[model samples]
Target: MTEPNTESTTALDHVHRARLYKLASLAFDRPDEELEEALVSGTFADQLLESAAALENDDLEEHARAVVEASPTDAAGVDELYSDWSSLFGFETGGDIRQYQIEYSPGTLVTSGDTLADIAGFYRAFGLSIAEGNRERADHLCIELEFLSHLALQTAYLENEGDETGVAVVTDAQGDFLEDHLGRWIGSFRETVAEEVDVEFYRALGALVDTLVGDDTDRFGAEPKTFEETPPSPLEGLNDGEGDFRCGTCGPTSSGSTPEMPMGDRDGPY
Candidate 1:
C-alpha cells in the first residue's frame, strides 16, 4: 500500500532513485567482477537499504532487506549466485529467461517495428549509449533500467542547478519511457526471473524491480499493459530507420548485427 511520494521532488530522492535503478541494471547484467565485489563486500546491500529508505517506501525497504539477506557474503556464495544468474539469463550459459521487452511484446513484427527505434531515441536524446562490452540490446531490461537511471540522475542534477525546464523534461521522459517500455513488462519479467533462477537473491531482486517499477508507474500515472505471454521472436522486419539496431539478446535479426549499437546523435533538449 506504500505509494510513491509524488511530492518527494527533493534532489536526494532523485539520487536515491537513480542509484536504485543503476543497481538493478548491474544486478541483472551478466555478473562481472565489479558486481562480484559489490555483492561479497556488502556495499550492494548497504546501498539498497540507503536508497529504499531515502524513497520512504516501505515495500522497497522490505524488498531491499530481502535482497540483502539473500545476497552472497563470500566468494563461494558469489560464485554460486553468478552461476545461477548465468543459467537464468547468460548467453554463454544458454540463459533462457527473456530479458528483452520485444520478447514479451505480442503481435506481428510490423506492429512492433518501431519499438527498438523508440527506445533508442530516448537513449540518444539523453546522450547515453550502451557500452561496447555490453552483450544485450537497448530493449534489454538492464539497458532500459540504466536509461531510467540516467534520467533520474539528470533530474537530480537539473534540480540542483535550479533548471526547471531541464527537470521537467527529464522527469517526463522517465514516466513516458517507463510507460512504453520497462513499466509495461517488468512485473511479468520479474516473475519469470524468480521462477527461472535457483537463488533466493535473484528472486528478491525480481521482487524489488517489480515493486520499484510499480511505484513509479503509479507516481507517473502511467498505465502500462502487462504481457500475458511471451510470443515467439519476430525480429526480421523490425527496422530502426538507419539499420543501426537489431534484436540480439532475446533473438537475433537476420543481419547478424546487434541492437547494442550506439544511440546516434540527436540535437536539442529532451
Candidate 2:
C-alpha cells in the first residue's frame, strides 16, 4: 500500500487574505500614526504575529482580502494621503506598483498595455498576488507580500497552538523573499519616497518598511549592505551652482583642490 502523506496542507482563506489586503491598503491610505496603531492594536496585528509564531496558513487568503478591503477605506478620511500615494505609486512614477500590476495582475500579467485604470483594475483583480512575479520589480512585491504572509501564518499557528512545520515554512518563505529580493531594493525605494515626497503617510510607511526589513534581516541572519551615510549638507552654505559638500569654512573652495595642511613641524619633531 502507498504511504499516506502526513503533512498538513493549509491554504489561505478569505479572512486571512482580507487582513493582508487591508494592511497594504491602510499602508497607502492612512497617516503613519493611524497605520501604526492599527498594526499594533487591531486584529490584523494580532493574527499576523500569532500566525508567524505558529506557522499556519489556514484562512490566510481571508486575511489577505481583509487587508485589501480595509486598506482604501481606512484612509478615506485623508485625501492628501491618497494624493501622495498616487504620486509615489501610480503608473507615471515608474515605481513598483506600476511594474507589479504589469507583471502579476491576473489577465494583465501576460498582456501588454499601460493605463492608470488598467493598473487599478489589475490590483482589484489580483489583490496581493500581484506581487508574485519572478522579475526584479515582482521580486520587491513578493518581499512585501511575503512579509504580510509570514505575519498571517504566524498568527494562524499561534491561535491553533504551536505548529513547528508551519512556523518553519512561514519563516523560510519570509527569509527567502527578503534575502533574495525586497531587501535588495527597498532601501533605495524608501530613500526615494523620503527625499521626493512630502506626505507623512509615505514617510512613515517608508520608516516602517525599513524597520521590517531590518527585523527580517536579523531574523534570517542576513548581512545588509551599507550605503554611504552622507549627512545632509547645510542648506545655508549652498550658493549659486555650488554643490552641498563645498567647504563652507574656506570660501568657494575649488571642488578639485585639496585643502592645505596646518603648518606643524611634525616631520622634524616626530
Candidate 3:
C-alpha cells in the first residue's frame, strides 16, 4: 500500500533513499560495536522513523521503531546480540542466514554465470563497484538493496534536472531489477531469516523485507521469473552412469578426469 511519493522536488526524497540504503547496507555488513551503540542511542532509529514518515509508509515506520525499542539496553546485552548477529550471518557457528540472491532464488546456483554478470554490469553502468575488501558478490542481498537505494537517489536527481527520459529510465530499471532479482527471492529469504534468528530486532527486519518486496511487486505488477522448473544440474545427472557426460559449464567429465568443480568454487565473472 505504501508507495514512493515522487512529486516533491526537495531533500525529502534524498533522505528517504539514504535511509533505505542504510537499512539495506546493515543487512549485509557485519554488525559492530558502533552499530549496537547507534541502535541503543536512538539516533539510528530516529533517522529511520523520520524517513519512513516522510515517505508515508506507516508499516516501515513501525518496524524501524520496533527494532530500536527491542535493542539491548546494556553493553553486555549488545554484545550478546552482536554474537547473535555473527551466528546468524557470519560463519561463526555455521550461520544459515544466506545474504545472496542466488542462494535463495529457485533454480539458481551459487555461481550462476549470466545472472551475476548482468547484475555486475548494472553496477558498473552506474559507476559502482564492490569494495576491494568486500567478501560478498555483487548480487549479494545487501549489495542489491544498496543498488536499489542508488536507483532511487538517481531517480530523484533525474527528476530535479527535469530530465523526463532519465527519470523514466531509472524508474524502469528499478522495476526490472526488483522483478528479475530481489522480488523473486526476497519472500523466501525473509522467511529464512525469521526462522533462523530469535532476536526480535532481526525478526522485525525480516518482516520489513517481506513487506517491502510484496508492496513493490504489487505496485509494479511485477511477475517475477521463476526458474523452479529448470533442469537438474549436470553434476546431479553425472552419477547416473547412463553415458558419457561433458559439462558445458565446467569441462569434460568422462570417468577418469577430476570431478566437475562446483559452480561457486571457481572464479566468478567479476
Candidate 4:
C-alpha cells in the first residue's frame, strides 16, 4: 500500500481529491447544456456527495451536501445560475471577482513573465498542456484547479503502480504549487466569492473548494501568504505599457462534461 505523507497524499485520498477539484473546475466553467443536464438531473450533486463521502471528511461531506441541496431543478434555476456566474466570473471589465492568480499578488508577480513561465513549466513537466479551446490564461482559477486535479490523479496512478518515488515527486510538486500559487490566494478568492456573490449555490461552491484546498494545504504543512484585495492594478498608471503574463503554450489538454463522474478536463498528461 502507498503511504500517505505531507509530500504526497495517500492513493485513495488523491482519487477523491481529484474528483472534488475537477467538479469545482467544471462548476466554474461556462454554464452549458451538459452541465445543466447534470445539475438538473442531480448527477452532479450525487457525484459530489460520493466523492466528498469517499474522502471521509466530515466538513467536506457537509459542504458537499450543501452543494447537493443547492442544485437547480429546472431551466429557470439554471438561468439564474448562469446569471450569477456571469456577474461574478464573466468577461466584463473591472468585474468585482478576479479569478486569475496574478490579480492578488502585491509585487510584479502580477505581470511578471517569470511567474507565468514557472506555472507553465509545471504543466509542461507533467505533459499537461492547456486545451486549444481554453482561452483562459495559465493563472486563471479554473485552470489552476484543474491542474491540481490532474496532479492528484497522477499521484494516485503512480502510487497504484507502487512507484513511491513518483508519488513523492508529484506530491512534493503539489505542495510547492499550492504554497506558491493556489493556497496563497484561494482564501482571498473564497472571501471575495462569499462577499460578492448573491446566490446560495455559488457561495456553497466557494466554500467547498476553499475547504478542500484548505485541508490539503494543512496536510502539506504549507502556510501560504493570503491576499486581501481583488481588483485593479496597484501599478495601474506607474507601469502603463506592461501587459499581463502569457505563456503562449496551448496543446492537448482535457475538458469535457459527462453525467455520472463529471470528468471535465482542460489539461491532462500527454
What is the lDDT of every predicted structure here? Answer: 0.81, 0.45, 0.69, 0.81
Expressed as tens digits, the lDDT of each residue in 1-270 for candidate 3 is: 124334443545654754666674674467776676766676667776777667566786677677667766677877887788888887877777888877765455655888899889888878999889887887788788888778878877777788888876776677777778888777777777777778897887777766665655554456676435235566876754654464536534334444565334333311
Top TM-score hit: 1
| Segments of candidate 1 deviating more than 4 angstroms | 1-5, 108-111, 231-270
Please estimate how well model 3 matches the true structure, expressed as its whole-model Cα lDDT.
Answer: 0.69
Give the candidates in order of TM-score, highest first.
Answer: 1, 4, 3, 2
Model 2 / residue 134 / CA error / Å? 17
Candidate 2 lDDT, tens digit per residue, 1-270? 112121342433323532443454456532466665564455545654443233243333333333333333343534555455566676544433331322322233334344334323433432443445533433334335444554545545643666676655554544544454455556665676668766554555455445455544555555545333434445645554543454444433234434665333423311
lDDT of 1 by residue, 1-270 (tens): 122334656888889999999999888887789898998888998998999988888999999999899888888987887788778877776777878898778864457769988998999998877788865667888889888888888988998999988877887788788788898889888877777777788889899989999888877667777777855345635656544364433332234446676333233111
Give the range where candidate 3 is weakest over 10 consecutive residues by summed lDDT: 261-270
| Ordering by lDDT | 1, 4, 3, 2
The candidate, 1 or 2, that scores higher on lDDT is: 1
Report the lDDT of model 1 for residue 97. Answer: 86
Off by over 4 Å in 3: 1-11, 73-75, 108-111, 218-221, 225-270
Displacement of residue 13 (Cα, Å) in model 3 is 3.6
Tens digit of lDDT per residue, candidate 4, span 1-270? 123345444688888899899989988876899889988888898889998998777988999988888878788999988887787778654346778788777655645678789889999999989989877789888899999999989988998899989977888788888888899888888887888877788888889999998888777666677865646656555653545343435445445554565343344322
TM-score for each candidate, following the candidate numbering: 0.80, 0.43, 0.74, 0.79
- Model 3 TM-score, all chains together: 0.74
| Model 3 steric clash total | 0
